[model samples]
Target: MKKRFCIASLLLLCLTSPWIAVAQTVILESPVRVVTSSDRSIFPESWLSPDINAEAEVLQESQIEPSRRVLYKVMKKYPGHILARNLETIYVLHRLKYKGISASGTNSRRNVYVVNRGSRERYTDAWIERTFHAEFSSKLLRNFPQYLDNDVWKKANVESFKYGVSGVKSVKQKKALKMFDPSLHAEGFLYAYAKSTLENDFNSIAEQLFLGDSRFWSVVNKHQRIKEKTDLVIAFYHKIDPKFSRSFFVSLAEVESAEIG
Candidate 1:
């Protein structure tokens, strides 16, 4: 009986040791991650319509107004790009693109644009821009599924000199490069929208946009600077549509860095 008791005590000590170590483990997670999946949002339908009167009528008639409206907007800070009178319309246009037609440019480079003639509001241009971004994101996911896998980011280096090795006209042939570099362009936008410093909690926005999770909106709501976070994320995403209307990047670092508190 004495030997059996001693063995049982030893086994208890071994189990408790692991628990003690686990209790001491440092859990480095942001407060932003606490957002529940129920917090995710699909932009409201009224946001897409250019006619405010029509939208209001529809809302009153149907008794439909979402509790939240994705809480993000993408538009041109400058004059040349598109503009939306109501921010919600931007997302509406995006949702519309999944069903609308996509037209690529005549050049070898694939520059896609959505055709939405039914839209009458001045903000129509901005909505179209939003659609362009949605289309580009869709294509990238289809063409480069590899980017979504394995966090190990692999970069390639290729140099082409105009001059030949033997001083011969290096211009053996100017291999006509494709219209654009989708990945590089996508990275540029991603970097631009990324919070200026690691301290900023913009990664929460990145996760929803790139990680295929809509719940990030709840995280945005928790932040004291909700508008700032929402504006930054949307502006940055929209900026890239015209230049890289075919694709964008969602880095592994971005996946790991989003704050949930």
Candidate 2:
């Protein structure tokens, strides 16, 4: 009887081992990695150009975990394969600058950089998350411009309206990048900085879409121009991946609001 019981116990363990291993693997896996400036490989080769003058500070030890949590929350919304193929690393720093100008965040080939909240800075987790989405969307836009119909995007804007030369110039001028202005909604723009360029406009919409900002949906529902542009943005994303459907974003917003509530 004792020998028979021991054999049964060993068989049970063998039968469940693979299931336990899968559970452990699922718990350990993360879509992307959050790194600091200490990892020299995070810097892009373009920064080496004399004209770039890019500078960054290493993140404080206390800031690392919070930054990771925020990034993980944002990245987990996408499919793992999408993340692996596009973004792999997030570099969190105390500060970032280029050409001697301060920047809240920026992206290189496959890595994105964001500034940690400082004593004097107004940076918040929401802001950081939005920056991550905005910068990453820029990379996606560049990688797959064919899906972004410039003619369709331009038509959605006000007739005969012209965009500013560059978003960089708008940032350099100290414009409020994220402020929501009702006055701009009729023009199919969500914020002042979006009017700076087509890419910035797309980035603004992309950030709001991915962040699942309720206010953005409110505006989209009330204004025809904003709704039109929003549809274009949704179509652009859906074209890139079928997973980015309207229902997915609607559900994402509900989930975000529930977490906040």
Which candidate number has the best lDDT?
2
lDDT per residue (tens digit) for residues 109-220 in model 2: 8878888864346777888988988999998998889988898889988889999987668888876467898889988988898999898899888888899888888999
Best candidate according to TM-score: 2
TM-score of 1: 0.21
lDDT tens string, model 1, 24-140? 111111210101111012213442445311111011111111101121222222122222211112112111221121221100013222333333332243333333344444333
Lowest-lDDT window of 10 residues in candidate 2?
19-28
Clash list (residue pairs), candidate 1: 31-260, 31-261, 32-259, 32-260, 32-261, 33-260, 33-261, 47-89, 163-170, 164-170
lDDT of each: 0.28, 0.79
Over all chains combined, what TM-score does candidate 2 have?
Answer: 0.84
Q: What is the TM-score of each candidate against the true structure?
A: 0.21, 0.84
**What lDDT score goes with residue 169 in model 2?**
80
